[model samples]
Target chain A: MCVLCGGFVVQEHWTEGRGSTGAASVTVGGGASRERQRDRRDRTAMANRILACYGLKLEDWNGSKYIVRDVKGSSEIVHDLGALWPAVEKLIKKTADPLDPALIGRLQQQQQQQQSGRP
Target chain B: MAANVKIPVIILSGFLGSGKTSLLTRALKQPQLANSAIIVNEFGRMGLDHHLLSRVEERTLLVGGGCVCCSMREDLVNACMELLEDMQRGAKPRVDRIIVETTGLADPSPIWFTVLRHPVLQHHFHVESVLVTVDAVNGMLHLDSHDESIKQISAADRVIVTKTDIADGEEIERLRRRIGQLNPAAEVELTDSEDTKSARFFADNPDSVRSPRTRCAMAAADGGREGRSAEDGRNGSGGHTDATHSVSIRFDRPLDWHAFGLWLSMLLHARGTDILRVKGLLDLGGEGPVSLNGVQHIIHPPEHLDGWPDGRRTSTIVFIMKKVQPQQVTSSLLAFQHMLGAVPYVLETDLQFPY
Candidate 1:
């Protein structure tokens, strides 16, 4: 159980890895707290790009939790990336096949557009 | 359980006739092992009824995929939990270590998943290593005809080719070569079980395999990974379509932890079973490299080292996989990084990348 808010303990997902306490300095001089927020933003944006394929959005909630919502505005609170994919599959009602050729093609197209500075 | 120490679990796995029991029996003779608990599949299999101290009943858990073998292995996590509780309550003697001897056809993933995923168990127990034994006499035949054998070999941190006393050196060499190709990171040892006190016996250096020494990263030669189908295809599982294969990729710079985690979770959610195991040291540009270890779908909680083991920050990950195309895995990863505008990763074959 958590001691701070007196709530149930949260299982640290593999994705969070070492988390902020043990986090390495990805942003050289950004304080650990700032680096953590930056890390959270990067995750939200990157995940949103992929979820766009399924018409979904992910928001970094308080730099600790994530809210994944579908095009229909249905949302779920995901503890971490470990729970995000399963939550996604439930929202879309389909296998979130990461290797699906179609999904890969979309990512490829977007990557190329970014390379050429295509807005 | 102490906040700083975790009990180590060593898993013994291999084909039905492999010398797992024999090795354990021999090791138990050591006075130091008095504090170790053994979890065998069944008493009949171990033939050590008197040694069976306690039996842990199976408890159904809402974990892992819904498969018959998976459900049975859930009992393994249950066994470990009960053992922990008994020790804590002084009902059972506290063991410094756990030795689990899996069934001949057991897949080590579910047991690993449950151990690493359980909120309570994860804190008290950590898998030290998976020691796989192969009978040197028929090892080649088994590898060529059994998918289970390949899975066991791939998941091993150390592969003991036993029964070498009577087996032909030629056959043993061939089997060892096959194991190396399947899992280049696994150290293969030739052991004549008759020589019970052989230098390669267990407990000499139980930490030998888990020493965080990352394998050298290199591109796999094409066509080296081809699965030898099992003789029986009637099982309808489409079991061994993709031959056991491994690939290692290195990133010149450190990884963006956020992106890496997202990509990995998506991959495991879709194709966890295809990935037999993965190990690596990822530099999140933190104080030290973050170690990553996983068995199929379940990943052990990452440990932040005090410093880089070799004073280098290059990230290298080796994936022991099956049926999954290595190119697709790398391409998707690179694509994710590309979207984040993070440094693009180089792979063995970037051409297979749709971009």
Candidate 2:
């Protein structure tokens, strides 16, 4: 199980893609979609979860595009994140790149290790 | 697992309007790229290229931010995992190759490192090549004006000259020569920005196209600015510019899996803010090396590929952080090693409960 938004929430046995059994109701727990918003991290995780339900491979790279690839094996367990209208609304709306520096920094460090033979 | 499959990623990097995306959209349409996956990193709130590619099988992940080498790397790794998962779950189309179309200001080094260093990612992916796209119409000017541009050229595994349709061929050739001097090993291809399917630029198997001399080029020349960490300045204290950066850690021996996870969780809980990405490739005893990657705070569930994609045996970890001391991180890892019964340490609990 992966913790999202600093473990403020817990999601286990997450559905991998969106199902075709009629669309899921867009209401999140808070009731109002327009007025209420979770913390940024939680919102992004929620978006990830939503993508999971849609059965789409949810991929994000800090900026604007969020990718959803179709899953391969079992159609039942997969949930689609984009299928939930409310979830898509949330992810598309939240825009911030928090892990940018770390991603590049680690890569440069690896290049150094490979060159120097440092384990 | 198809052990015979070798997916070599060719990265097209350059600054905006330099024709990076243009070249990629064109490359995807080529018949040779039929088995390729294209991952695009877009900047800002809206993505443009996601809707531009004509191939349905070309997986697209648009990451918005400063540059892929820094900010959106987790997404890059996660994208790969999801692509694999999708393949396994029968959700997404499967491809034999991959390509990452970077933002204009992207520094190709980090993107390359993600594939080369991340424990989980390193196995399934390889830095087959780094293709830097240069806008010929503004090549010299861009190089003279931007520090990022210089880094792009220096790090390229291949240099592609774009927008030659608008510039004089002689001047474009001169620009090509300049690129060659900066990156002597890279193969330079001049392309008309608008033409995508021209046979002139496409190759059947890009992985086999490198010259023997280029393949044998000095590691120092390819090292670029990343090598400067030891010599550039700042007293060799891992002379890093950004506080939150990624560093890869490796362990050759089989990890005490439980201990390693405990150490990581404790570190993340305490300094998660400073640490942005953590991906490990490890010898988990009987199961082979399992790959795990985390972004910001979300760790994708660990996945096991067939085996090491290459024969290399070091269990590695690439850490992406913010301002935390590398020594502190190293020491903590060392402490974990000692906890693994490899080093002497004073402790109360034998096989501690939490770990």
Candidate 3:
């Protein structure tokens, strides 16, 4: 347990919904669509940051792997959003067990506001 | 270009008033260095050396942020990338190698570590050698009085005694012995004619062969892993921030880039003096890992690389600063994460950002 942040491990919403249902319903509770969307937004943001550093424009490609052409030679740096998004989602789920629906809903609202350039 | 051609980096280091610039001026005249790229860091008010060396006015990369490796390592790397890109774009004589000249009062560790730790650099370029020059006229006095001078000697792969034409033979011999005692592995070369050949200096070493200095560096990296956690954040011995120290910041998930950009700009602006260098592999929302770097006030845009060399989830940012609190820097960074609703491990509040 990290003394810095209280030992409180915030469970993933899916994990909490099921974990509370006892042993019989443990594996049945999958999370709402809200948590998954948050994961995707976070992953996409990560991708954009990576592309920006490489001198590549995000609007250049239609959301697929691209090649990073440098002066030395042209090397390929592929960004497969399909593969990365899921992994980030999995990591979010594992670190926090028994996730909060209210937090997920707030995060979704934040995401929409971000997409709309509101806040 | 098909079969991977490794990039070669040549380090030029020396003490104050030493013949480092003089030697570089001499080396640039050589036919071998005709197509090479030079990275220079500035510490003094006047930057006459850049003007002096660019007699050809071809392509001279002025790394004015701070000390290379410590404060300007990322800038050095970015400069190298730009140079490489220029070479590919049919700009010059098609140069592949790079020569980095450190400031007179600079430590060689950060530069050395930058070369060692960079993933792209390791794949593209290998550190050919660390060549340090000692001034024959005031060499002994500088070595005796300056800790920076001692470090320059200690980390040398090759030691060149300059201005031998004017100095007494006995005095030159004494200086040679002192350098040898500090580091016996480095081969000592004496030159007064300024006719040192670039081919002769960096030729045999190549990237394949491992020299004594490289071996020591490898040993230091391995044996010093324990100290890395502590030293990574500690400030350096220099009263002015040393660029070699790095601050590592890890994120649990991808961060909000806008917040990150704001935080970075704020950090760089507030502590520009202390922050000599910044570089990291960032997890862009949906993208893999993007590498970001900044030197002094200039964050050289950004470079979206091919992919992580390995599947490392955690995002790491290293800051080489002087006389700054690592905890404060870390907390400031954490505040950015907290704004994004990410909880980070608050390592230590008073952790030294020593390099």
Candidate 4:
């Protein structure tokens, strides 16, 4: 059990390609504070792109957990990026498929926009 | 099992009648694997294979009546947990390795899931390798017919071709070629009765899997080229209707581990079944590159290598896939890698949901 968030999260989450762990519980250990925070923020940002596909928004909560909320106000407290997808699915009732033509198109377009200095 | 202690697990899979039992029996007799336990899983109402290898006695547990991949997945987990419990309680002798011999029809992915996904099992056990057996006589026919056989071959770290005495030389050659086309990274060998004993294979490898060597072999298959599909010169891709191809991608810049993990996790979540295996030597701007490997949805924790094998700063990743579009992987990975050092201040709201 993690003293930080009360669950066995992360490290395990980082290895999970299945993208489904459960509930809200993240623990930060090792590494310098700045580097760790930056990784967390980057992870959250990458997740926002996928979650937005399902009308869900993700935010880092106190650096220990994440808050995932849908446009409809239905929300879930996710433990880490690994646990975010299922929470997004539960909130929007659909698979947040990365290979979905729609999602890929958006990610590609977003990359293009970022490249072209477009907001 | 303690929190940090890990045990090695070898998943032995083969098509029905591929001589898995005979090989396992011979393996148990060897000194290298003598202190090993077996968990034999068989499909159907009863399992008789466990009785055949009764030499291991209490160490051999029979998980019967259902496939390890589907129906009796929990039973497989229980069997593993029970092995740990038995050893801990002194009911059974402690062993160095656990070999889960799946029924011929079982897919190794779910068995991997049963170990990796279980909270206790994940911490207590680590899958060392997937060893698949292919009998030379019908192996080609099975690969030409069965998807399970194809998956077993694709997931293999080592392939043991059995019954060489009965199988003609030419037939064995074809089987070997097909196995290569299916998985170029797999180390294929004949069950020559001396090779397994000599190499000290599954039982002896207590170290992490050398995915770098596997990647090097995969790259070498394409003549050491990058971005080319390894699908050419292969007839029909080992009975798969679609081209089961491998694509090698190179990155000139360093990879941000966090971002790379995120992209891969998302990709695996949706397309894991189609994407069979991935091996990469990632350049994290460190003195050495870290190795990343995945079989379907289960990506093993990355291991850092001493240094680049080729001494190149450019990171190399190879993907061996079945039915998945290479563009799906390439485009997404490149897009994510672009943000390695760029400020991620841009929010999701900034990009229009074009889809």
The per-model DockQ list reads 0.35, 0.04, 0.03, 0.23
Clashing pairs in 4: A25-A79
- Interface root-mean-square deviation (Å) of every model: 7.4, 14.9, 19.8, 10.0
Tell me which residue pairs clash in candidate 1: A24-B286, A25-B285, A25-B286, B227-B243
> Which should have the higher lDDT, number 1 or number 2?
1
lDDT of 2 at B68: 33
What would the per-residue lDDT of candidate 1 be over residues B1-355, giving only the tens digit for each residue?
3323677777788898887788777667666565677787654644444445444443445433453222325677667778888888999876767777778887776667566656778788777667889998887777777989888887877788888989888777667666665665566777775665542334445453334222211112111233322321222122352456666666767677766777777887777778877766676777866667776766766765555544655676767778886776776766666643345443332012343
Tens-digit lDDT string for candidate 4 (B1-355): 3212467778889999997877877676667776776777543323234322222211222132122221226666677788888888999777777787878887776666566656677777877678899998888888878888888887787788988888889888767766665666567778754445722555554453443244443342332332212343344354453456655566657766666766666566556567777766666677766666667756666655565655665566667777776665555654455555322211111011222
**TM-score-superior candidate, 3 or 4:** 4
* Overall lDDT per candidate, in order of appearance: 0.65, 0.47, 0.49, 0.62
Ranking the candidates on lDDT from highest down gives 1, 4, 3, 2
Error of 1 at B146 (Å): 1.9
lDDT of 1 at A82: 68
lDDT of candidate 2 at residue B26, scale 0 to 100: 65
The candidate 2 chain B region of ten consecutive residues with least summed lDDT is B344-353
Which runs of model 1 end up more than 4 angstroms from their true locations?
Answer: A1-10, A19-38, A62-64, B1-4, B45-52, B55-74, B91-93, B196-242, B306-312, B339-355
Q: What's model 3's TM-score?
A: 0.40
Arrange candidates by TM-score, descending. Answer: 1, 4, 2, 3
Per-residue C-alpha lDDT of model 4 across residues A1-119, encoded as one tens digit per residue: 11111234525564322222122345576545766687778778867765665677889999888899988777789776556655666677776665577776776677777779954
Tens-digit lDDT track of model 3 for A1-119? 01111112221211111111011222334554555445435544544443332333222133333333333443444233212222222323322110223333443454556669954
Candidate 4 docking: what grade? incorrect
